[model samples]
Target: MSTGLGRGAGRRFGSGWISGVLAVTCGALGYGGVLCLLFPSWLTTPSARALYPLELVRFLIYVMLVLGFGLGALSVVLRRRKVLGFTGIALATAGTLLGGSSAEIGTLGGTTAVGLDWFLLNLFILALLFVPLERVIPRLPEQAIFRPGWTTDLMHFAMSHLLVQVTVVLTMLPAGVLFRWATQPWLQDAVAAQPLALQFLEIVLVADFTQYWVHRAFHRVPWLWRLHAIHHSSETMDWLAGSRLHLLDIVVTRGLSFVPLYVLGFAPPAVYAYLVFVSFLAVFIHANVRFDLGPLDWLLATPRFHHWHHAANPVDKNFAVHLPWIDRLFGTAYLPAGRWPEVYGISGSPVPQGYWRQLAWPFLR
Candidate 1:
């Protein structure tokens, strides 16, 4: 199958597609942001909400509501395809009528709600960062922003993020219980006592080592491949495509990776810094950008390094996420010197398209 959008992925770029995209993205996410503010205790992640500046968030929502409506109007006037324009306008109008940024906050509750806050913030921030980069230095210039399977990948991103609380709980439950006995206070104190920079490096190294094996196992094991095939099913690669993973894949791999970090007990700040860094790195590797990192590509993971991992021809290789050297050490690295893969996705045993279909796929097959 062609990796291109094929037909009816949406209108051409020169048309109002760009404006419509910005309008709908801003409107929908802004609406979610306002709901997060209004129901901080119920709609937000406690750990994440504490980090956000309420006033700044409120201001951004107000600005986005106006921007969405204005851009939507511009699109409506400029193009015949009024669907995107109309959708943006409706979302913005509804958000404004629902008190815009100043939505009322009632009594707070202890119960954890859906992570609307995480979803909106991550989607907004990552889209803003990667979209422009991809357009500016696209690996495949003809690769449109909205590819054939984009909406499906987008739904995967949305659901994975929206259920952050549940995923986090599940990830931590196994790691914490299985490795609880391994937390040596003396060792934790020593680990924490190390310089913050050193601690951060150690965390990445430890986590990467664990995930490297877990990642390889997914590719090697037959039953596991059934679940992992959904990820490889994407015929295209992009920042968004990385989000197209089986929910169980996320939990198991990340949960196992967390074991080392939790047991060693790195300092919270260092750990938090690692979390921020890893999140960006994960998306960066999957991005559809042409970034020639030169020698650093060998020392660290890069888009080329990762894109090879998803190559259609190279069934199982380049298993490490952060460190390419890990793959080199294990003789599983397949990054052909200075060459990009001709195609992506698996060869046989095709995984079906669409979010719900892919979700139910592993079991049925």
Candidate 2:
């Protein structure tokens, strides 16, 4: 890979842009095809059910097929990067042909549901939103769109998104099994009876407090630190970098965090709302967009607050992911007034570069 550009200097457009477009196109097609063939039951995502009808999604797939072929043809005719363009077209065609035939639509009752469609949709929407935001109000103005480790981070993002079903299952397993023993219908009923606004607040408090301690443990414990360090190894902080997490980290943090929420028994609607809100905040806090939250920074975690957590100069502080007050309360918080870290990433990170390698890294060394 080429050396990453400093602030404001963009990557080489021809190689970077073509490769990226080809990668995303091929990745979507490949994932879509697999879901269609082996896991048709998992195709319908929660976001898809809530947002659009199945027919609309089908129409969009058809449109994508045409666009992919058109782009491939144009690239081949122009004799510019024909290989990538052709590969993208081929994948797109195959995926469309394989997955286009849908017998039924809407949300289906099942034990598993992958967020493939949701992932792609989010990829598009977030790219549209954050790409511009980063470019205009970039925290690191010189950072290129296609940074050195972008592909690795993209793989992490794709895997996490694609394996949403598995993740959900693994995360809920603790809650499911443990809550079975502590089942209290009356407690759940009482909790659900509360106002939606109040329920949301309670859910946030329960989840964040549990996560804060779990996150701290992942840092202080040497064994767990091996896994958590993958998240801190990214040299550049962006919306996508947030997805570079080890599977162990995800399963442990999310699974343990779910315990309190389940035991407390918040309503499904409020729980969903809190999930949506935190999801947005997770990406937002990692985003490259520069903003001054001022007083809000102390109350809530923002990009600036979270960025400091990833800074090489002080890698041990800012363990809180949601509420800054949690960090402040525990005395792990470290934020300077009107300043950003001059550097990011851990010093001499042992975490490997690729997704597969990082997955096995914790077990090895």
Candidate 3:
């Protein structure tokens, strides 16, 4: 009887492993194929004279990212121990691909060199920042962490920033036309007279404020919470977990977050700088790294603070993104002295496991 029970357990484990591997394989292939079909231009290498011609390299890098994510997901599904290692490898490969000369995409001067430098710098910075934390965080319980799939969460995060950047650039076209068609010379002159730094600050502040409100709204509205919950549902809190937001949520929140910055006349350079800085902070705040900022916690957000937001109990606090001041001012701040929630994620609801289902669930419901 004991032998039979052992055999039954072994068969169940084997079956689970097989199912996970198949899911990862199918997800990667399906995602890659769909991306290739939908954005054929993204796969094309531009002419030699093109300022940013890194299209082909970018495509290949994305492929590697997909594969790496697949491997990471597979590791989780199989209950293997190399999930972070595989994810790191994938991130490194993506960095290398973006660092190559062929991955340039914009009219920025010295496109190839600039792209290479930015890619390498960002890769190094993110790796240095998160790799250590990945090492430190305890392995999450199986039920709490989402099993890895196609790394769609990362893709979602990337696409949100990328689309926002692209849209900001496109807005300049209309700004130029308005400049050309303006009936009020004083208005144009007023904008021109504004100091570069002040103008930049105005843009960033506007964007930040907009994002804070949008985030708050997501929590306040039940329908939207369905989409947003996917982000909060991750039982395991880590760098990658920050990328788990649904695409619809990304579009709405990011679009609202960016429009104010664009309309306020924020220079592209300033916007880029702010984004890089905030991106770094976002990763740090969501990371499993242990650090205490003491009084500074009241001023800025951190992992410990944000983790509380992800807690299952008393789900009405910690909605501000970068600044806790907003939460405090609005009476949503719930941090108590020397106390932290013991567990994170939604208490009840049948959440989907894979990226595709999560993406489609909002629409289906």
**Cα deviation of 361, candidate 2, in Å:** 0.8
Tens digits of per-residue lDDT, candidate 2, 22-43, equal 4446446544633543454576
Which stretch of 10 consecutive residues in model 3 shows the poorest summed lDDT?
110-119
Instruction: Give the per-residue lDDT digits (tens) of candidate 1, residues 1-365.
Output: 23244332346654677788888988898788777767778888887767788789889999889888998987787667688888889999989888898888645779766888888889989998999899899898888778889999999998998899999899888878888988899999999999999999999899999999999889889989899999998889899999999999999998999999999999999988998999999999989988877977878899999999899986688999999999989999888778999999988738988999999999993
* Clash pairs (backbone) in predicted model 1: none
Q: Any runs in candidate 1 off by more than 4 Å, and if so which?
A: 1-14
Determine which window of 10 residues in candidate 1 has minimal summed lDDT.
1-10
Per-residue error (Å), model 3, residue 109: 17
TM-score for each model: 0.95, 0.83, 0.60
Tens digits of per-residue lDDT, candidate 3, 202-252, equal 655666678788888898898888888888777666676787787677667
Q: How many backbone clashes does every candidate have?
A: 0, 5, 4
Could you list the CA RMSD of all candidates, in the order they appear? 2.8, 4.4, 9.3
Could you tell me the lDDT of residue 193 within candidate 3?
Answer: 63
The order of the candidates by TM-score, greatest first, is 1, 2, 3
Which is superior by lDDT, 1 or 3? 1
Estimate the overall C-alpha local distance difference test score of candidate 1: 0.87
Cα error, candidate 1, residue 42 (Å): 3.1
Better of 1 and 3 by TM-score: 1
